[model samples]
Target: MPRLKAEDAERREAAGHGPDFLEALARGLAVLQAFGPERRQMTLAETARVVDLPRATVRRALHTLVTLGHVESDGRLFRLTPRVLRLASGYLGANGLSAILQPRCERLSAEVGAPCSAAVLDGGDIVFIAYGQPARLLNLTTMVGLRLPAFCTALGRVLLAGLPEAEMDAVLAQHPPFAVTPQTELDPLRIRKRIAKARSDGFALVDQEAEQGFRSLAVPLRRHDGRVVAALNIGMHSERGTATVLRDSYLPLLRAQATDLAPQLL
Candidate 1:
């Protein structure tokens, strides 16, 4: 449809390309994002609908991307080329967090016989950046790119503990906590106390708080300056054990690993 181009043209014309803004580039990137992990390939109509762009605009963007070796297309289907991975690889390489933490997470997962991860705060949520797991069957599982509300999760609490008082309040205010489970805590005062404990105690553990039948323990991963940057967590089914058991048994090991890895992250 010609409408997508017209829509984009309207945005650019309104902005007058002010102060380094590039509407066409933004639209092309949006087209690329329409292909996610679950959506590996799309027909023209699928891409147009997913990106909410007009079909003609999507077609032009796809053609430009294909020529630049960022996208590939058959006569009827379009998909991202492997070249797109360069974007993620550059992030992983530049940060070096995944490279340094992933192997440690694997070892920790094997030792604890549970899933393990490292996550960073994003607004009112925590996003998993590195993940590892054992073979135990779980009712719920977390993976890289999984996002969970910060207040109800051990990972989130430990990360929130890193922030100063005003900043932490602002972070929490970004989203009103809603129930994922009956056990999820939404009270600001109670959450503030949990974060305080996580800061003084250096770890947080919760059972059936984020989700029913699941438990997690987390420790802060800090830089050499001792500023927390991410959280390291281990999660298991609630049937496995209680929060106290993990705190006494697995937490020492988790903290040790986090401490050992902190300097490497610098």
Candidate 2:
């Protein structure tokens, strides 16, 4: 296949662009995002299938990304290069939210001897921007930049709860709940109720939904204007604590941290 020239690619991508929107850039980002933990590397055909774009289109995007050092291709398969992390690092640096929340998450993790994280809702997923883990080794590991479904995590629930009712309904409709585990809630009505409860109660507690044997408690990190910009959560094994124990013991701590950080989020 011939490499697509910049102008040619832009002309081809014009079909999806509006007056201000850059369709070519969006396609490039979509192609970059198609590679994930499950898909460390993929062939051109596989990439086309995953992104639902024509093989030629995906090839051009991959070729352009490779030229920019954001992706690497061995002529058959492609993978994201370390240079892509620059995008994440740049966002963290400019946004400053991760830097601000990192120390707080570490303190919370140390206090409870568990893993803690802060995440923001992006589309139907929650992206971890900051994370902390205790000194001791544990079976599970969570980290920054991890993305998980919104309907199944405490962090995600709290973040979603912060959205307006109509917006929340649309989001739920767009991404219907799926069962991550047997304990995961698949009912949209029940999930909405849980989100509503989080909005009213100022906290969310989820048990073994995202991962079996893991229970998490979360609270919304709000700005001075009372707008929730992120969610804070801590997770532990279900064997270590029941739902009531997690709620009673950890909810206050989470809420306290959220409150303390609210003023800084602005």
Candidate 3:
């Protein structure tokens, strides 16, 4: 596919500008996102290519990020530093859902002997804000601000299932499927069917989709106004539990947590 032109992207952003708009902030965020797994240590040219910004623009943004200690460059390669976590930490600290859901997730993890997490849908992915794990040795290293595909994760599916059908379709249309594992659903029709089932059942179960041998079950966390603002999930190895176990044992606990958390979210 052809790369998005820098001028075109700038034009699109200019069209959206308002009196209170911060275009510089938007461009900075775009630069940060450009340094993902594939393009981790980008030079100025590569950063511009990935972010669809002019090389000069990206150079300035990198300099600003470096000055702020959010990014570090070793002469040629540039990458984000741990200071970027501060930004996500500030957001999570200010958000009510993370505070309320943290204790509930811990309780659920203790009760179920599995890892539990609460995540919010962000664009085409889910971002885990709170998590708990009973087994300290379990190698699930995901932390707050880690992003994963929405189609393959139980939390993502639950969030997507809660959306209106039209909105769900729009999101799916934008994310043409990429296989993360053999069990990952790629067909749009099949994904729609799975989402429909989740909507009706009030939960979502994903097995070996995001990663090999990983299984998870999730329920939507609805607010007082009945809008699903997040998803609660318990993750474990598929060999450790069956779908029936998830439905019979974990589902009720997750539902109860979600019910208790609904009132606490703003």
Please report the candidate that would top lDDT against the real structure: 2
Question: Judged by lDDT relative to the true structure, which candidate is superior, 1 or 2?
Answer: 2
lDDT (CA) per prediction: 0.86, 0.88, 0.85
Clashing pairs in 2: none
Q: Candidates 2 and 3: which is better by TM-score?
A: 2
Name the best candidate (by TM-score). Answer: 2
Instruction: Arrange candidates by TM-score, descending.
Output: 2, 3, 1
Question: How well does model 3 score by local distance difference test?
Answer: 0.85
Model 2, TM vs. native: 0.91
RMSD per prediction, one decimal? 5.0, 3.8, 4.0
Off by over 4 Å in 2: 1-17, 138-142
Error of 3 at 238 (Å): 1.4
The 10-residue segment of model 1 with minimum total lDDT is: 136-145
Question: Can you give the TM-score per candidate against the true fold?
Answer: 0.72, 0.91, 0.89
lDDT score at residue 246, model 3, on the 0-100 scale:
71
Clash counts for the predictions, in order: 1, 0, 0
lDDT of 1 by residue, 1-266 (tens): 59966775677678786545676788899999888668989999999999898899899999999999999988899999889878866876777777888788888888888888999898999988888888664536447666788999999999999999899989888777788899988788888898899999999988798989999999999999988888999887878777787778788888888879888876
Superposed Cα deviation of residue 89, candidate 2 (Å): 0.2
lDDT for each residue of candidate 3 in 71-171, tens digit (9 for 90 to 100): 99998889999898788889989998888888888887888788888899887799998888886546656566778989888899889998888898899
Error of 1 at 91 (Å): 1.6
Q: Could you tell which candidate, 1 or 2, scores higher by TM-score? A: 2
